[model samples]
Target chain A: MALARWPYDDLFRLFSGQAGPAPRETAGVFPPVNLYDDGSVFLVRTEIPGMDKTSIEVTTAGDQLTIRGERVVAPAEPGASYHRRECDGGQFRRTVTLPQPVDAEAIEATYKNGVLEVRLPRVPERKPRKIAVA
Target chain B: MGTQVQKTEAGTQNPEIQVREKQAVTREPGTWEGPYFEPRVDIYETADALTLMAEVPGAEAEDLQTDLKDNLLTVSAKVARVDPRWKPLYEEYSVGHYLRQFRLGEQIDQAKISANLKDGVLTLTLPKAAAAKPRRIKVTGG
Candidate 1:
C-alpha cells in the first residue's frame, strides 16, 4: 500500500497481502498496469484492449508519469444477455511517481496488441557510472 | 466424453456446482485461496460468439495454451522472469504462470474455438453453436 494512490500500486500491494477493492463497480476504471526498472530505463506497461490508440494520453510532470484513457464499452445488443461481465469500461487516470529522474526528451511510448509500453531513459547524471583509479 | 458432458450438464443445473464454478473465477491475490495467481480477464458476448480477453504481459504466443475438455475451457501461459542480471530496486509484479478456467455452456461450439495473442493480451473466440444462435423461422405459405 506504499504507492496506493498510483495506478500500478495495486500490483505491488498484491505481494504484501493488501487487497484492492472488489470488482464490479458500475463506474469502474479499466486497464491494469505494470511498472519496472531495467538498469538504465524505466518501463511502464498498461493493458488496454479494443481501445483506439488516439484516445490514450500520456504525460509527464516533474517526477510523475500519468496515463489517462477511455475504454468504450460495446453497446449491448437488443436481446443480448450477459453470462459474464468482468471488463471495466470507462475513463481512467493512473499516475505513478518515478523512482529516479528521467530524460524527458528520451522517453518513448509504444502501443501494440492492447499493451502500451512507455520507456523512460534515465538522465545521464542519474545513471550508474564507472570511476577510474590511478 | 459422454459422462463428462453429463457432468457438465448436471453441473449447470446444480446450484452448488454453479457456485463452485464461479468460485474459481478469482482475479489477483487477496481473494484466492491458492498460491497460483489468476490472470485478469474480460468475457464479452457478441451475436455469434463470446470473446475472452486476458491480460498476461511478458507471455509470448508460444508460451500460451488453450485447452477445452468436457465443458471447461482453460487458458494458461508461462511468463518468463526478468533478466537475473539486473537487481530489483523497487519490486512488484509476479513472475510465473498465468492461469484461469471457465465452464463453457452448451451454447459454445467447442470445435470452432480459436485464440490469438498480441503484445500481452490473449484473445479467445468461442463461436456459438448453430442451435444456440437465434433463428427467425418464416412460414412459406404465409
Candidate 2:
C-alpha cells in the first residue's frame, strides 16, 4: 500500500518533541495487516485481540477489501484501580487494496484466538496458465 | 495527555487507529530462531488480587508458559510459524513469539496465582498475601 500521508501527521508532530521514542516510529495504520499469496489464494491476516467475532465485519468490493470492527474492553472491577493501561479499546476500519483481481464470491473469513484471516481466491482467469510450446 | 487525544479522535467517523509497533526483546547468549515481541498489557490492582491482561495474538494455550522466580514474574508464549507455502507479498506486521517480565511490588500468594487465555488475550490473577491486604482497625475511646 502506497504510504498515504496519515491525516494525523500534524497532530502527532505537536507532541513529538515532548520526549522518549515518539510512539513506535515504524507503527503504521491500526490493525496492521500482512498479505500473503499462495498461487490460488491471497490471505490477509490481522490481529485484533479480545474482540468478539460478532463485532467484526469484512467486505470486499472490486479490488478493495475492508475490515471494520469494534473492540470493547471489559471495565475494571468496581473499586479496582489500574496500575498501567496500554491496550486500547475502540472502533477500527482498514481497507486494503488487492494486487490482483479476486473471486469475491468465494471469499472466506475466520476469526480464531483474536486473529482474523480473510482468504481471497484469485479469479480463475487471473491465475497463471501453464502453456505448452508447439 | 496522549491517551485523551486518542479517545477523542476515535469518536470521529474515520478514526485513525493507533498501531504501536511491537517492541523487540533482547535475548541471552543462545540460539533463538525467531523474533519475540513484548506484548502490550494492562495491569490493575484490587483489594484482593492484582490482575494482568496481555495481548498475545496467534498464541495457543498449550504454548503459553508463565514462571515466577524470586520476585520476578515472566510470561512467554510460542507462536507457530506461518505456513511455508504462502509467500508474503505486502507486509506491515511481523509475526513471532511473545515474551515479557515484571517485578512484583506487593506480596503475592504465589501458590494461588491463576492464568487464563482466551481469544489471544491472557489474563493472570495474582492473589495478594494475607499480610499484604489492608485491614480496617477500630479505635477505642481513651
Candidate 3:
C-alpha cells in the first residue's frame, strides 16, 4: 500500500497504479493548483473566488508558468461585527515548471465560476510522432 | 461603539497566504454518492441581519441549493466533473461538491432570507426577526 498524503491522491493512484505522492506541499501554498497532461496539451487550473478578471495576470516563459492575482474583500458594513471569519483577502503569486516546452503563443486561459483554466499546447517537435515501418 | 475590523492594507508587505483545504463532514448513510467538501464561510452580524459568505468554486448558480428548517441552515452545491481524457500529472487540490450546515442561535425572519451567488461565492442575508432586533427604550425625565 502506498502512503498517500491526500485522500484524492490515493484514489487516483489506486486507479492508475501510480506510486508516490505529489512533489510539492499542498497546504502551504496559496491558490492550490491541479496540472494535467493529454499528450498534445497541458491544463492548469486554480480556484480564486471573488476576484476581478482584470486583476489576474498569467504569463509563460520557456517552460515556466506564472499566475499572479489579488483578492480584495469589501470592508464590513458599518456597525457590523464578525461572528466567524475564515475567508481572507490579499495578493498571491505562483509559478510552476512545465514538464515540456510549450507553444506559449497558442496558450489559452479562461475563468468561470471562480475557476481559472489555462491550456498550454506542447511544441510541435516535442509532441510524440508516429513512424511508419517499410 | 462599533467593533473595529482589521483590514489588510494595500501596498504594504503582504502576509503569506495559506491554502485552506476542504474538509469532509460526517453524514448518514445513503446520502449523495460522491464525496463532498465543507466550504469556508464567513458570518457577520449587523443590527438588521446576519450575513454569510461561502467559497464554492466551480459551482454553477443553478446547481446551488439552500435549505432553512427551524434554525438549521444547510448550503450545498453540485460541481461539474472534469473531462476524463486529461490524465493527471500533478494535483494539489481535488474537485468535489460542497456542503455545509449552520445552526442559527438568533431568531431570523425566514421569509426575508435572501441568497445570491457571484464569482463562486454564495452570499446569504438572514434578516433578524422583529423580536430579535435590538431596540432602545427612551428614558423620560422624572
Candidate 4:
C-alpha cells in the first residue's frame, strides 16, 4: 500500500474513492487559508496556533503573499509521560495569489491569539475611476 | 425500529443494539459549550460491522484503555485540567473524563483494527470479517 506524504498528489482519491478539491500548487509553505475582500483591501486569516511571533516571516510581492512560520515542540514538561498528542507543530508555509492586483507597499500583517491576519490594500490609482462624459 | 433489541435463542442481548440505544440517548453531552470546541472524529462501518468513534481528548496515551468484555466494548480516558497563575477570562470548556461505551456485534475483525491521530483528529479503521464483507464471485470464460 502506498502512503501519503507532503507535496502530495493533486488528484488523489481517498479511501471512499472520492476525489478531493483540485490541488492548489504554489511554490511555498502554508496551510489552508481564508481570504476576504473589503472593497479596497484583502484580508487573509490563517490559523497558526502555538507559534510565537519571532518564528514567523511574511512578505508580499506583486499580487502574491507568503507567510512562513515554525512551531518548535518545547522540551517535554518535566516528569511528563507520553499518552496522546493531537496538535500540529513544526514548520508551515503558505503562498496565496490574490484575485485582484494589490499595492505591495501598503500591505500589513498582524498576529494575535495564534492567528495571522494579512491585509493587502488596493492601489490609489486603481481606486474606481470616475469621470464626466463629454 | 430497525434496531435488533428483540430476544434471540442465545439468551444474551445483542451488544450492537444496546450500543445504538446508548448512542441515541446521550446524543452529545456537554454540547452547550458552543460550536468551536468540536472534537475530531473518524468512523468506520459496514453492513454488519458496528462503527464507533473514540473521543479521547486531553487524555494522555497511557491513560486511555479499550476493552471488550461480554460483548460490551468500553472506551475510557481521563483528562486533568491544570489552572496556573493566569486566570481564565471566559472559560466555557471543561476538562474531565472522556468516556464512551458501545456494544459490538459479531462479524467485527477486531484483530486487524487500526488507529491513528493527526492534528487533533483521531481515526480508527475497523475492517469487517471475511464473512461480513460483500464479495462478488468471478465468472469463468471459455
TM-score of chain B of each: 0.67, 0.85, 0.83, 0.51
**Pick by lDDT: 2 or 4, better one:** 2
Q: For residues B15-126, what per-residue lDDT tens digits would candidate 1 score against the true structure?
A: 1111101122346553223334467677777779888877665677887888888879888876655565443333233345577888977578888998888656688888
Candidate models: Cα lDDT each: 0.63, 0.81, 0.82, 0.49
Candidate 4 C-alpha error for residue B91, in Å: 28
Docking class of 4: incorrect
lDDT tens digits by residue: candidate 1, A31-79: 4445566678888765565567898899988777878776665655555
Candidate 2 residue pairs in backbone clash: none
Give lDDT tens digits, candidate 3, residues A17-100. Answer: 774644344735678888887789999999998888989999988888888887888777988999888888877878877767
DockQ of structure 1: 0.12
Model 4 DockQ reads 0.02
Q: Lowest-lDDT window of 10 residues in candidate 1 chain A?
A: A21-30
Give lDDT tens digits, candidate 4, residues B61-115: 5555566665575565444443232221111123344455556555557787665
Instruction: Summing lDDT over every window of 10 consecutive residues in candidate 3 chain A, give the lowest-scoring window.
Output: A1-10
What local lDDT does model 3 show for residue A69?
A: 84
For residues A53-81, write the lDDT of model 2, one tens digit per residue: 98899998888888888788898999999
My TM-score estimates for the predictions, one after another, are: 0.61, 0.83, 0.83, 0.41
Off by over 4 Å in 2: A1-27, A126-134, B1-16, B27-32
Checking candidate 4 for backbone clashes, the offending pairs are A29-A93, A29-A94, A30-A93, A30-A94, A83-B60, A83-B61, A84-B61, A86-B120
Clashing pairs in 3: none
i-RMS, each model, one decimal: 10.6, 7.2, 3.8, 17.9
- Please identify which of the two predictions, 1 or 4, would achieve the higher TM-score against the true structure: 1
- How would you order the candidates by lDDT, starting with the best? 3, 2, 1, 4
